[model samples]
Target: MNLIETTYQLNQKAKHIAKVVSVDNATMTNIQLRAGEDIVEHSSKNDAFIIVRKGKIRFIVEGEPVVVTPENMLHMIPLEKHDLHAIEDTDLILIQIKP
Candidate 1:
């Protein structure tokens, strides 16, 4: 199992991201964001699983905004347009699978 500790201190800037675990050419990334941090509306070429590790995240799917908090997750179908926003200090893990 890939074990990781959520070290808040290690998460700085957050503009980039902190690598957590990846295998077999797969990519796993964890991002810590302060309140108000958000990604612009965009589409994904690969399917993505967005998990809320801490705090809450506000996401828009099909033009409707949905709030996902700790223990909550959402799946983005490939090439789906969406918007993601961090309502509060949030930590999110994004798992990407290459097709």
Candidate 2:
């Protein structure tokens, strides 16, 4: 088994960080965002889901706002257009699978 640490280990200096922690049958990415930062609007290239490790993020999906907190996880289908805004300092893991 391989263990990967989150923002604590990988994102100490940047406002936004995206790293592919694993890639075999699927890809696992560690993403971090500092308070007030946002990921530019884009489309999911593969089937994906986000596991929130800390703080909150607002997902704007096709203009609809969906707030996700530490208690929540968000999933998206391939090619879905979306944007992510950090409501607070946040950390998450994005698992994407090719379909």
Candidate 3:
């Protein structure tokens, strides 16, 4: 078995991303963003599940904005247009699964 760390580090001031796990059909990515940082709109060919580990984010899907926090997770279907803006210092994990 293998182990991976999925925690946030304090005092993070810039956008950070790391791919912690990858296999034939899926991947797990860790993303950290400071307040006001954003990811430009894009679409993924694979289905995506986003889990907010800390703080909050404004997740825009197809031009609709949804606030995401640690209490809930977000899922996006394959090829859906989306983008994210960090409402505050945020840490999240993104899991993508191939069709």
Candidate 4:
């Protein structure tokens, strides 16, 4: 996955912007989110986490919202639903890992 630069188009109707950075070993998937965008509440069987790489976010993980800025990290355990909204021009690192 180091060599595989990928992207997953989100809901255009919801205005979510993102790109898949890598999907390593099928157990870990890394994604990057763009500003003025959001990730709607959803969940998977795996554990999920996020790292704020740049800017800020009004992040909602498991039904709670918090302001997260650069260098901050958020984690969502297995089966947890979440949503993330960019509070400004921002970038984020999203990870989905095997339980």
Task: Give the top-scoring candidate (lDDT).
Answer: 3
Score candidate 1 by TM-score against the native: 0.80
All candidates: CA RMSD (Å):
2.4, 1.9, 1.4, 4.6
Better of 1 and 4 by lDDT: 1
Q: Candidate 3: where is the Cα deviation over 4 Å?
A: 7-13
Q: TM-score, each model?
A: 0.80, 0.86, 0.92, 0.65
**Candidate 4: which stretches are off by over 4 Å?**
1-35
Give, for candidate 1, the lowest lDDT window spanning 10 residues. Answer: 7-16
Task: Give the per-residue Cα lDDT of candidate 4 at 6.
Answer: 38
By lDDT, the candidates rank as: 3, 2, 1, 4
Full-model lDDT, candidate 1 = 0.79
How far off is residue 56 in model 3, in Å? Answer: 0.2
Clash pairs detected, candidate 4: none
Best by TM-score: 3
Evaluation by TM-score, superior candidate among 2 and 3: 3
Candidate 3 residue-wise lDDT, 13-81, digit = tens: 477899999999999999999989999999999999999989899999998999999999999999899
Alpha-carbon lDDT, every model:
0.79, 0.81, 0.91, 0.62
Could you give candidate 1's per-residue lDDT for residues 19-72 as a string of tens digits?
778777557888777778888899878888888878888989779888988767
- Give lDDT tens digits, candidate 2, residues 1-99: 876655364255756556656566588888787878888999978988888888899999878899988788888888889999988888888888877
- What does candidate 4's lDDT look like per residue over 1-99, in tens digits? 166443333323334334455355324344445567766787878776677666788867666887877767777778877777777655556676753
- In terms of lDDT, model 4 sits at 0.62
